[model samples]
Target chain A: MPGQRQSQPLLALRGVSKRFSAVQALVDIELEIRAGEVVALVGDNAAGKSTLVKVISGVGPPDKGVIEWQGAPVQIRRPQDARLLGIATVYQDLAMCENLDVVANLFLGREIHRFGVLDEVEMERRTRELLHTLSIRIPDVRMPLAGLSGGQRQVVAIIRSFLGSPRLLLLDEPTASLGIQQTNQLLDLIEELRDQGLGVLLISHNMSDIKAVADRVAVLRLGRNNGLFDVNTTSQEQIISSITGAADHAVAHRPHPEEVWP
Target chain B: MTNPLPTKARVAEYAGGVRRRVREGGLGPAPVLLALAVTWVVFQSLNDKFLSPRNLSVLSVDIVGTGMVAVGIVFVLLIGEIDLSVGSLAGLAGAVFAALHVNVGMTEWLAVVVAVVCGTAIGALHGFLFAKFGVPAFVVTLAGLLTWSGLMIYLLGPDSSISFSEDGLVASLTSRYYSAPGFTYGLAALCTAAYLLVSLRDRARRAGAGMPCRARSGIWVRTGLLAAVAFTTVAVLGHFEGLPLALLIFLGFIVASDLLLRRTPYGRQVLALGGGVEAARRAGVDVTRVRVSVFMIAGTLAAVGGLFVASRFTSASQVSGSGMLLINAVAAAVIGGTSLFGGRGSTWSALLGVLIIQSIASGMALLGVETAVQFMITGGVLITAVIFDSLARRTAASRVRT
Candidate 1:
């Protein structure tokens, strides 16, 4: 499955399996996210895309298989553990204090402090620098997150995660509820992240999104991976078939997902 | 470029041409003190004792109980919460103190320790429910208000109750009057030194940390002005009496509350949570813990305030805290500058607001103002404060482009 691997393939998931009670959520899923690449994990609802993300980002434990980072196997037990590995998550629901200003939200848990005192000036300065770095233009940094539009809050959330200089970013429905402009903005942001040499695991139901920015596409049909294809080489029809359990669905060694999941 | 002056002179002049505005803004504490001065002139012109040292010291004493309560409330309010039970909680602490002394044969000092511990325990209980179970603070503390008051009343049976006499230690806290001028002068010096030390240390630390620093001249000017104000206040008090212990306690509460809210990470977390709990949690803040701790701090402060109330009257009664203690605490916090909606405030505002309120009350009492009229005046003032606060919040938010 390794085809001219990058200088340092950032993340590799091998035979990763997870089960929820009686249902197999993920089954021996093999995937790789390369540095400076946007990998699309596309599937329908309950295709185990979310479960895969939870495992990679330390939200859930994979009962089977290994998660390797730069050739070494590691177990991510919590969100903090994932973060320490330089992985940031952007969930679908906005995880921010709606009432606080932008600066306050960006520095909520990890605040600047001096001699046991809050370093307001340093925080304010760093906030300006981070915003400037992201090129996310806002007239002021003191407004509440609630006051921002949904798309704008998404942008803030993106900026916040990247502020820690994350190695991998897992985005869940980055633009599910966004409008045309917001979607475009998010797409642009995704491209921007790849340009910054980040390994992005974009979990999107949007067909066009998977087609647009994804360097590699991994489709999961029920717990099993249907097929992993380079987006540049694979057609939308092939991906659609693989996702809906058409290709490699029933071939004994690669049985149809309906047999395993339905 | 052509000025052949000494290195120091050129350094001062090359980049810094002819100085125009040396400082900007009216300065912190200036506006509040100015308002106080203007009020004094208006009230003094209306009545003779309005500006008298005797009435002024009494006014200072009047603020201690409510002042301490307001100070603690400032913490809770900063994190965007409240404690409705503080008045009664304080009363309950007092009853506990009395029972410990009279029934358990404990020393008075030992009873005081038990009282504080009992108050702290109550706060912890409130915190546990609010923090762990996600119970609303208003409801828990409201329940606290009722339950604690009932407990206090039950504890204060008609026959078994203890009372402090005119010369008792507790009674002396409020009644003792300093006739000499030294205490007032000493208070003035202490206040000025405290202001200078705090501001200078904060400024230096910030500068060392590669952050903004206040202008040296600005610091000096502000400190000088405060020193002047403090001295003036003492001089006025010197005319009849020195300083009251209540005033010191009130000031102490203000300073402590200010440090807690403005400097502590706990304060920052509280504000963040008040601003947005989900956001705080995502940011890795132990949101539940902060929420509970704030309420506990508020409860403890309320109990502290109750002790002051008990000391002032030298007795704890069912009707002791029945009037406007809760209202006054809220009024003080709001009037000083804290927002009711949470996320933006300071403890100093609470102190300033209390001073302003007590000043008005004292002025009213001096002129023998009618009770109904006084209530109307206080109500009117509170309304103005609310209007100011809401306006300030709007303006503050307006400047931000989120």
Candidate 2:
């Protein structure tokens, strides 16, 4: 299957650059994700990881870049443009209305309607089926999102992204608010996505999450690509060193004074 | 999930649901209803004729004017916004209508249409400024309040008042009524039957789709309550001047607005925008369009309300939409349980709220209370309602956090 795969990457960002007024948020950032791949993007503070994701998700278009999707260059000027191109993004904040119920949130903008009225029964039925398929157990789908746990909300957000059946999924810190068990469940879900031949962009600060599901680790430092390593072949220290831009620093190689004294 | 539960279990679950909702500060209409009951009792004790059929009929007509405006406020408040211009716009509409019909010799219906359209245009302008130009709704509508009221005064000219002939289309709005017992009772019966049929149909659809449906017993109880209220209201009105046309129109608008807000996609979008603008935007909703249209609705309704106000007096004057009209309309929406913060209210709030305010005003009038005292008391009630809202919001937020 790998040999028969198309020569083009599912999504590729070539020399993408973004600037916000006086600040240059991203500079010549290059990235790629192929089908059935889970690429974890790890970076320190102000490394433009979020900027890059926003550019791809079309929330904030890049000032200068070439975004190639399915081997052809495309322009993603707005969120609708990205959606039409089958690029779904779940932002760090979840972007959910807490007052609305699970089913309402799930079908919010793309609600099913009959004769201009909302087809609530159909929406609810589909929501239940979707939740059951994902093994997400909520006491009630009609409960407001405010009543849900952080993990449940995160799961709901992810499930909402799947509503359009996009080719690529952009998840920004999906497990940031999850407990240990919930985190494992999320990681498992990511793996399930990969197995379904969807390219997944997993952005995180946690090394364990990266190692658990990511096939490749992409490190960004100070708005530049420091390194990209295969998760199976690279060590966590290597990824951290690349992310912090301390691979060649004397401090990183220096021995501790206490160790020498002991 | 689709399995039907036993009747006893369903009833228990329904009771538990209500209890949980109240505990979570989702008070629904309970507090307002209690307040209404208290007001009725207190006013009845103070004056023998407070609850008299003639007074209630008068009160019903009085509420229609501001109540219509309050309904518009509910839409704006639902999206967590305010339209301070509604009162001024109401005055402008009435002035325009009176000038066109009386001064310009235009047909009454044409003048009414033109006035309402003028309101819609002004509201659209407000929406455009707020949505497109990023002007705060507060500031835009504040300017609107001043500008529209000024326009109204200018339109009224040096005379500052215009009285249209009686028996015209607008004058008949408040005067006409279904005085016949058969017509009033038949109308009430129709409303009750329609509500029951609609509820049952919805239940059947939900059941067929394997969703949690309301208990059969619960449906019957709700229908019975509605029937009792409908019959009682009409019967009381029959004792006096019968069912006033103004009240019927006001109720019709409330019911229609309620359905629009709850059942339609556009209504959902308005609600979603109210919940969180950013979320709605990310969800692919047309935030600007919805915001603009909501203001248009407010403006249009405010105009209609202004016409009603004029019809009550059979004239348009400087005081038509001035003084307590704006405050009363806003207070009614908030007092009816629509949150000032938006995204958690219903249109029916306007009806309940207007009823409460009108009742207080009517009762005070019957008791010959001073206008100064009435203002202070109404102010106190407004503050209390706001406090309740703030407290409930805090509780809801804390619940979400926990």
Candidate 3:
């Protein structure tokens, strides 16, 4: 069963289209991610990066689409459904309870219990172990999330997704506020997860981050897929053209940057 | 990860933490404790009869009935919500109990049970509207405040009041006292022993896990201090009528609620949900269930408290749970160290908060002050408590940052 499960792509989307009233947020999107691969989804601002993420993460359902999980069609109508299908989402906002301690936040929804009581000792131990394995430097697990730096808070949020050991991870702007050193650390963790056979969908704007660990790059422009490239073979300029909808065959072509940014 | 501190360094670290706490005005209940002490000293000096055992005993019992309502408020406030309906809820509970038992000729115990259930249901309704419908808790409960008060008035008929039998079960709950003073001292001793036991067990667990914990000597010192405080309280209250049942009930409620908050998963979830609803929802917590359940608990406890007050007076009237009851309960929770913004407070705050408010009220009354002056003084103290809470939170945030 494990071997058979490993043979299929972890997640696949076919002809997915989502419309918000008059706006076509996502149109006829087709994407796939296999185990042991990092797929970077990049696009310009307002290119529907967030909308696509929400659809996949079950924050909102696509109006028209077929979502396949491990070679079987599945419907993700809510966040809980996505979780049950072994898909974990680390949202852009991080969705953290700042007042709770690190251990509490990490085990917020699924608390360990002994004799019908919160097993703080066990939770704290597990928290310490996970942080140590990730080599995340948090001063104290007992410290509230409010006190942690931006990078540390992001690390905790990502680790929360890791707790479920999902087959697929959806990270939306996980490194947005992080510094260079923190971003590097996060890239290393993503690489590690990929090596452990976790399929990661990294939604990022930073080209450097996409190049650092992504195995493949999928570019979105104006609610449509512009291009897909092998990171090993594609040049940075090629991906940029795809993202900017300047590629000759790209959908929803825009005027050159001089006409837009100027 | 960093290695665990050695014995000597761990002890020094513990000492440094304590010193920092003192410098930071001892976060949590320390400020309130100090304020209470100061208030007691001033009142003692101002009135010769203030410190007398008889007067002290009365003051202790008087705080308990209100203490019950304040305990529920602590739960609400801890989650960063307010229940304006608690006063009306309590009044309605008392009125319901009286109407059911007196007017309807039902069994007293059965009526009390039904009254408490009514409180729970009403509270759940308020919680449902707020949590499920996304109505503002303040608005929902504010409407409840008016609605329940009106219901209480209507329940009591034309007179809007009903008296209980003097020797009834509920009446004896507050008015009675232990036969001997030794029981009071023994209870204090038992509590001290329990504290010592829990601390020792926790220390051992930390040691076994190779986690840093308080020094052995520090734990002993804390235990000794707790014992001293317990014995002193017993000595003071034991002089008059041993221990009042009301105060004992209040203390028990505080301890049980403290256990629920600290030791249970539900309590942690309440704090978590209060801290961030979205985060909790993502984590698989039934946010609506937790919110609604907390409101129900608040309502039921507030009603229970009202019953205590009614029992003390042996009557339920339109004015029984009205007037300053709501403000005093909330003020007590805040003064005791519960944060108005939520996600940081303890059940013990209710006990401390009620004591502080009642002390001032009792003291002012002893001084022959007018009700207006009492209101102003209470208001001033509540404002002071909020200021202190804000300062302490800032200090804690800064400390955590470093």
Best by lDDT: 2
Judging by DockQ, tell me the better candidate of 1 and 3. Answer: 3
Clashing pairs in model 2, backbone N/Cα/C closer than 3 A: none
Each predicted complex: what DockQ? 0.27, 0.54, 0.48
Please give the range of 10 consecutive residues that has the lowest summed lDDT in model 2 chain B.
Answer: B1-10
RMSD of each: 7.3, 3.3, 2.9
In model 3, the runs with Cα more than 4 Å from the true position are A1-6, A17-24, A61-64, A75-78, A248-251, A254-262, B1-5, B9-26, B392-402
TM-score of chain A of 1: 0.84
- Determine the backbone clash count of candidate 1: 4
Per-candidate local distance difference test:
0.74, 0.88, 0.84
Please give each candidate's TM-score: 0.76, 0.95, 0.93
lDDT of 1 at A118: 79
Q: Candidate 1 DockQ category?
A: acceptable
Model 3 DockQ (Cα-based): 0.48
**How close to the true structure is residue A89 of candidate 2, measured as C-alpha lDDT?**
89
**Candidate closer to the true structure by DockQ (higher is better), 2 or 3:** 2
lDDT of 1 by residue, B268-340 (tens): 7877766766656656677667876776677677767776787877776654566488888888888777778
Q: By the TM-score metric, which is better: model 1 or model 3? A: 3
- Model 1, which residues run further than 4 Å from truth? A1-37, A41-82, A91-94, A97-104, A121-156, A172-198, A203-213, A218-229, A236-262, B1-42, B159-161, B165-169, B175-187, B190-194, B197-216, B387-402
Residue A230 CA displacement from its true place in model 2, Å: 1.5
